[model samples]
Target chain A: MTDVLVVADHRRGDLRDVSYELVTAGRELADETGGDLHVAVISGTVDEFADKLNREGVDAVHTVDYGEEFNHGVYTQATTQLYDELAPQYVLTPNSVNGLDYAPAVANELDLPIVTDTVALETDGETLTATREMYGGKVETTTELEGPAVVTIRGAEWPAAEGTGDAAIEAFDADIDEDALGTTVNGFEEVGGGDVDISEADVLVSVGRGIEEEENLEIIEELADALDATVSASRPIVDNGWLPKNRQVGQSGKVVTPDVYIAIGISGAVQHVAGMKGSDTIVAINTDPNAPIMDIADYAITDDLFDVVPALTEEFH
Target chain B: MKILVTVKEVATVEDEFEIEGTEIADQYLGADLNEWDDYAVEEAVQLQEAGIADEVVTVTIGPEDCEQTIRQALAKGADRAIRVWDDALEGVDLLDVEAKTEILRGVVEEEDPDLVLSGVQSGDDSWGATGVSLAEDLGFEWAAVVNHLEHDLEDGIASVRRELEGGVEELTDVELPAVLTIQTGINEPRYASLRGIRQAQRKELDVQSLADVGVDEGVVDSDLELTDMYEPESESDVTVWEGSAEETAGELGDLLRDKGVAP
Candidate 1:
C-alpha cells in the first residue's frame, strides 16, 4: 500500500494549527492511495511534540529531535531520511515560511517533484493532482504531478484534524551536513512589538488598498473604536507602512476568524480571502460593485467608503 | 560582485476574464514587468548604487516581446539584460514550475553571479517556486519572502528578514553567492527617467535561445500541464444595501445589533 507522510510545522513549543490541517489532508490522500498516514515532527523535544500529534487517522508519528528552532538544513536532512525509509507516495507540508524553506531543498535532494501553495489535492490511483490558484485567486488551475511528489498545503483549506489516538511514535536520526547549513536564524523580532494578535479578535474592521492615504486610516480607526473592534488591514496597507504587520489580515498576514469581519475599501484578493474567509460574518464597503470583495461579502455597500464609513461610525456611536 | 535579478512579463486583466476552452481569453492589457519583480530590480539597483555590488544583471525567460520588460529594468539601472527564449518554448505551460526552474538554472549557470534575486512569486502564475528551486539546483544558500535585506560584502554574508505568515518576522543570515526571493514592499521601485530610458534603448539587450543556454531540445518539457483554466465559483450571497450613507449606516448598525455583532 502507498503511504503518505505529513511534515508537521511547529514554532516555539506549540504545534501550528496547520499541522492538524496537514493531517486532515494527509488522511484524505492516504485514503485515496489506500495507504497509511504518517506524520513527521522535527524538534528538540520530539516526544512532547509527537504526543500532541497523536490524532485520529494517523497511523504513525515519526519524531526527529534536532535543534530547538526550525533549521532548514536539519529539516531537509531529517525529512529526506524519513522519506527514504517510508517511501511514501506523497509528502505534505504546510506552505508557511518555515516549510517553504526546507521543502524545496528536500524535494531537490530527493529529485522528487514538488508543488507549492496547493489549495486542493486529489489522486487517481498513483497519479496525484493538485489545485492552486493563480493571479490573485482570479484563476484556478488544476495540475497533475508526473510522479511521487512533495506538496505544500495552504492553511484553512483543509479542516484541522481532530480527536486523539494512540499512534506509534518512532524516533529517526539523520546525518545532517554542517557544510550545507549556510543560513542561520539569529532570532525573531516582532514587527509590531507582539502587542496585537488580530487572530483572536472577535470583530475586525479591516481596510485595504482602497484606503487611499495613510491619513484616511483615522476614520477607519474611529469606526473601529466606536464598535470596540480591532483594526486590521490587507497586505497593501501593511506594506505601505500605514499599518503594523501584526494588524494585517491575509495569506501572508494573520488568518483571523473573527465573529464579524468588516472589509472597508478592500478589494478581496484571493490571498486576503484565504486568511479571513472563515469569519462568520463579512461586510464589504467599496465603491465598485464588481469588486471581488463584494462577491463574498454578506453585506455589501457599493458606495465610497469615505461616505459610508463616517456614517457607520456615527451610527455606532 | 555581480548581482542577477530575474524579471517576468505578465498580463494584467482588470475586468472579468473569460475562459475560452483550455485557455484564458486574450483580452488583457499589453504585458508589463511583473509587479513583484520590480521590487527585486529596485533592491538590486540599490545594492549597486550603494557599492555593495559591482554590477546588476537582469534576465527573463519569455517570448521576444519580453525584451520590452527587460528594457524597463535596464532603465531602472540594471547593468545588462539577457532574454532566454526559444521557438520550442512557445507551447510549454507557464505554470510548470519544474520547466521554469530548469530554464532559470540554465541562466544562473551562464551568469555565475555572486548574488541572484527574484520576486517572491510571479504575478501571473504565482507558483513561487522557480527561484527557490533554482537555488537548490545551484547549491546556494537561499531565503524566500525576504522583505528586508542587507549584505556584508567584506564578510561575504547577507542578512535578511522574512515576511512570514501570521505577521511573524524571522531574521536569518546566509553566506553570500546566495539566492534571495524578494517580497513586495521591500522598497519603492524608481520610475524610468527620460534619459535613463534613452540610455536603456542604446544598451545591449542580448537574446539567448534555449539551445544557447545549454537546454537540450525537449529537455525543458513540463511535468505539469494545465488541463483547464476558469474563474472560481463565487460563494458570495451579498445583499447590496442602497440609500444615503447615513441611512445605510443606520440600517447596517441595526442589522449588526440584530445579528449580535455589536454592543
Candidate 2:
C-alpha cells in the first residue's frame, strides 16, 4: 500500500494546531491511496504530542523524544530515519515557519520532489494534484507530480482531526550524528511588546501598501484618531519601518479579533487576512474593486484612500 | 569572507489580469527584483561595508531579460553577478526546488563562497524552499526566515534571529559556509544611487550556460507540472458603496457609526 507519513509541528511546549490538520490531510491522502496514515512527532513532549495527534483517522503514531524545542538538524535526521523505516509514499508537514527550515533539506536529502504551502491535495495513487497559490494569492494553480513526494500544507486548510484513535505508539530511536549538526539555537525572545498592544483594541484602522509614502500615513492616523480607534497596518508598513511590529496585523504579527477592522489600501493577502479575518466587522477602502480584501469585507468603499479617508474622518469629527 | 547572494526577478501581476491557459498573459505581467531578495542583497552589502565580508557576489537563474533586475542588485552594492541560463530552461513552466538546488549547487561548487544569502521565498512562486535545499546539496548549514543578523562573525559563527509565528524570534548561531534565507524588515534596503547604477554597468555580470555551470541539460527537466491556473472565486457577499470618494466615505462612516464602532 502507498502509506502516508505526516510530521507533527510543535513549538515551545504546546503542539501547533496544524499538527492535527496534518493528520486530517494525511488521512485524506491515505484514504485516496488505499494506505495507512502514520504520524511522526519529533521533539518537545513527543509522547504528549503523539497522544494528542492520535485522532480517529490516524493508523499509527511515531514519537522521537530528541529535544525540548525544534532543531532542524534533529528534525531532518529523525524524519529521514522515520521515512526509511516506514517507506511511505508521501511525507506531509505543515508549511509553517519551522517547517520551512527543514522540509527543503529533507526533500533534498531524500532526492524527492517537494511542493509547499499546498491548500488542497488529491491523488489517484499514481499522481498527486496539489492546489497552491502564486503571485501572493492572486491566482490559484494546480501542480501535478508523480511518485513519492514531500508536501507541506497551508495552515487552516483542512479541519483538525477529532476523536481519539486506538493506535499503537512507537518510540523511534533516531541515530543523530552530533558532529553533523552545524547550528545552535540559543533561545527565543518574544517581540512586539512596547507602548501599545493592538490585540486588545476594539477598532483598528489598518493601512497597507497603497498609502505609498510614509508621509501619507498621516491621513490614516487622522482617521484612526477621529474614530478613537487604534492604528494598525499590514506587513509592508511595518517592514518599511513606518509602523512598529506591535501595530502590525498578520500571521507573524498578533492575531486581532477586534470589533471592527478598517482596511485602507490593503489587498488583504492571505497572511494579512489570517490575523484579522475573525473580526466582527471588516471595511475596506481601496481603488481596486477586485482586491482580495473586498472578498472578506462586510462593507467596501472602492475609492482612493487619500480622498475617502479624510472625508470619513470628517464624518467622525 | 566572501558572501554570495541569490537574486531573482519575480513577475508581478496587474490588479486586473487574464489567465491564458496556465499562465498570466504577458501584457498583464511586469518584472521586478523579488522583494525579499532586496533585503538579502542589503544584508550582504552591509556585511561588506562593515568590513566583515570582503566580497559580495550575486547569482541569479534567469534569462537575459532579468539582467536589468540583476543590475539593480549590483547597483545597490553587490560587487559582481553570475547569471545562469540555458536554452533548455526556456520552456520549463515551473522550476522545481530540486532543479533550482542542482543549478545553484553547481554555482556554489564553482564559487565556493564562505556564506550564501537568499530570500526566504520569491514573490511569484513563493515556494520558499530553494535556499535550504541548496544548502543540503552543498553540505552546508542553513537558517530560514532570519530577521536580525549580527554583523560580527566571531569564531566563524554567524548569529541571527529567526522570526517565527506570533512575534517570537529564535536566536541561533550557525557555523561558516552556511545559507541564511533573509526575511523582510531585516534591514532597510537602500535604493540605487545614480553613480552606483552607472558603475553597475561596468561591473562584471558573467552569463553562463547550464554546461558552463557544470550542470547537465537534463537538470531543467522538473518533475512538477503546473496543470491549471485561475483566479480564486470570491466567497463574500459584500455590499459595495459605489459613488464618488466622498459618497463612499459617507457610507463607510454611516456603517461604522451604526455598528457602534466609531464615535
Candidate 3:
C-alpha cells in the first residue's frame, strides 16, 4: 500500500500540537487513496510519542534518537536515508522552521514532487490535489501533484484526531554525514528573556496603524491593562517606528491562538491575519468598519477611536 | 560587509487556473518576478542601505526570462546581478525548492559570500524553502522570519531577531557570510523608482552556465515531478452577516466564537 510519512516536531521531549495535525491530515489522505499513514520521529526515546501517533491513525512510527537536542544534519540524513528505503508515496511535514529547511533537500535528492503551506488536500484516482492560501489568505488555489510528493502543512489547517493506528515503533539505522554539517547549539538564551506564551494568552489587546502615534499607544496600554491583557500590533506599527518590531503580528509575526483577540485602532492586513486568524475570538475596533479587519472580526466598534477606546477601557474596568 | 543574495523569476500562477485530468491546466500568469523574491531583493537592499553590508550581489539560475527578475533587482539599487544560463533548463522546475537550492550552492562556491541572502521563499509553488536548504549545503549559520537584522563585518558576526511566540528570538554571535531568509516587513521593501528602473535596464548582468561553474546538474534527476499545473478549487457556500452596528458586531463575534476561532 502507498504510505504517507509525517515528520513530527518537538522541543526538548514532548510533542507539539502541530504534529498531531499533520497526522490527522495525513491519515485522511492515506485512507482515501489506499495508503497507510506513517510518522517519523527524530528524537530521544520517543516510544511514548509513537504510542501517541498510533492514536492519531498512524500505522507505524519511525523513531531515531541521536541525542537529547535537535541536529539538522542528523535529522536530514536519517530522513533522507529513510525515504530512500521506504519509498513512500507521499511525505508530509509540519510547515515550521525545521520542515522548510530540509524537506526540499530530501525531495530534491529523491526527485520527489513537493508542495508547501497546503491547507487542504485530496486524491483523485492516481493524483493528489492540494489547496494553498494566496494573497494574504484572500484566495485559495488547488494544485495537482506532478509525481510522488513531499509537502508541509500550515499550522491549524487540520484539527487533531483521537485514535486508531497500529502504533508500532520501528527504529532504523541510517547513515549520516556529520562532517558536512556544523554549528552547535551552545545553550538556550531566551530572546528578550520573557517566558510569556503569546499563543496561549486568554486576552490579546492588539494595536495596528489606527493608533496613529507611538505616544498614543499608552491609550492602548491602558485598555490592555483594564482588561488585564497583553499588547500586540500589526507589522506597519513596527515598521513606522511607532512600536517595537516585536509587537508586530502577521504572517511574519507570532501565530497566536488566544481565547480573545481585541484589535484596537488596527486595520487588519493579510499578513496580520495569517498570525491572528486562528485566535478563538477577534474583536476589531476601528473607525472604518469596511476595513479588512471587519471581514473576520466578531465584534467591531466603528466610532472614532478617540471616543470608543476610552469607552472600552472604562467598561472593562 | 559581504552578503550573498539568491533571487528568482517566478511566473505566478494567476488568471483562471483549472485542473483537468490530474493536470494543472495552464493559467496565464504571463511572466513577472516571482512574488516572494521581491522581499528577498528588498531585504538585501535594505541591509546595504542600513549600512549592514558593503556589497550585495543578486543571483539567479534560469533562461533569458530570468534576466527580467535580475534587472528588477537592479532597478531597486543592487550593485550587480548574476544570471546562470542553461537554455536546456526550460520547464525543468527551477521553481522547485530543492532544485533552486542546488543551483544556488554552485553560485555560493564561486562567489564565496560572507552571507547568502535568498527570498524568505519563492512565489511559484510559494513554498518559501530556499534559505534553509542553501544554509544546509554551505553549513553556514542561519535564521528565518527576520523582522530585524544586524551584522558586523569586522568581527565576522551577525545578530538576527525573529518574531516568535509572545516575544522575539534575538540570536546573537551568529557568524557572518551566513544565509538569511527575510520576512515581508523587514523594511517596507522599496519599489523601483522611475529613474532606478530605467538605470537597471543598462546594469551589467553576468551570465554563467552550470558547466562553466565546475558543477554537473545531472546528479538531480527529476524523481517526484509535476505532470500538470492547474487552478485552485473553490467552495460556493457563503456565510454573510448583515445588520446595524451592534447587530453586526454581535453577529460577527457570535459567528467567530461559534467557529471556536474567537471568544
Best by lDDT: 2
Per-model TM-score (chain A alone): 0.89, 0.78, 0.90
For DockQ, the strongest prediction is 1
Q: Please give, for residues B111-165, the per-residue lDDT of candidate 2 as tens digits.
A: 9999999999998989999999999889999999999999998898999999876
Evaluate residue A203 in candidate 1 and report its C-alpha lDDT on the 0 to 100 scale.
89
TM-score of each: 0.92, 0.87, 0.77
Query: Sorted on DockQ, highest at the top, how do the candidates line up?
Result: 1, 2, 3
Q: Candidate 1: where is the Cα deviation over 4 Å? A: A193-195, A209-216, A225-228, A250-257, A267-278, A287-290, A302-317, B241-263
> Candidate 3: lDDT over CA atoms?
0.69
Considering TM-score, which of the candidate structures 1 and 3 is the better prediction for this target?
1
Off by over 4 Å in 3: A12-14, A44-54, A163-166, A170-176, A241-243, B1-3, B9-55, B61-78, B84-94, B102-115, B123-125, B134-179, B184-203, B207-263
Taking every candidate in turn, the Cα RMSD to the unseen true structure, in Å, is 2.6, 4.5, 5.2
Q: State the fnat of candidate 3 relative to the true structure.
A: 0.18
Which tens-of-lDDT digit does each residue in A1-317 have in candidate 3? Answer: 56778888775566777889998888888888678777888866577777777765777888886765555556677888878777777888878765665676566556566788888887753577778765445456666754478888987779886766767789877666666554343333344325555565677888887787889998888877766777878877877767654566677667777778888777776668778887766777777766777777766667666666665565545
**Considering lDDT, where higher is better, how would the candidates rank from best to worst?**
2, 1, 3
TM-score of 2: 0.87
lDDT of 1 by residue, A1-317 (tens): 56899999998687888999999999998897678999999976789989889998999999987788888878888999999999998889998878878788788888877888888999864778888887767778887766688899987789988899778999877777778888898988777747577887888999998889999999999999999989999998987788887897875577888878999988988789867887888989999998878878898888899999999999877
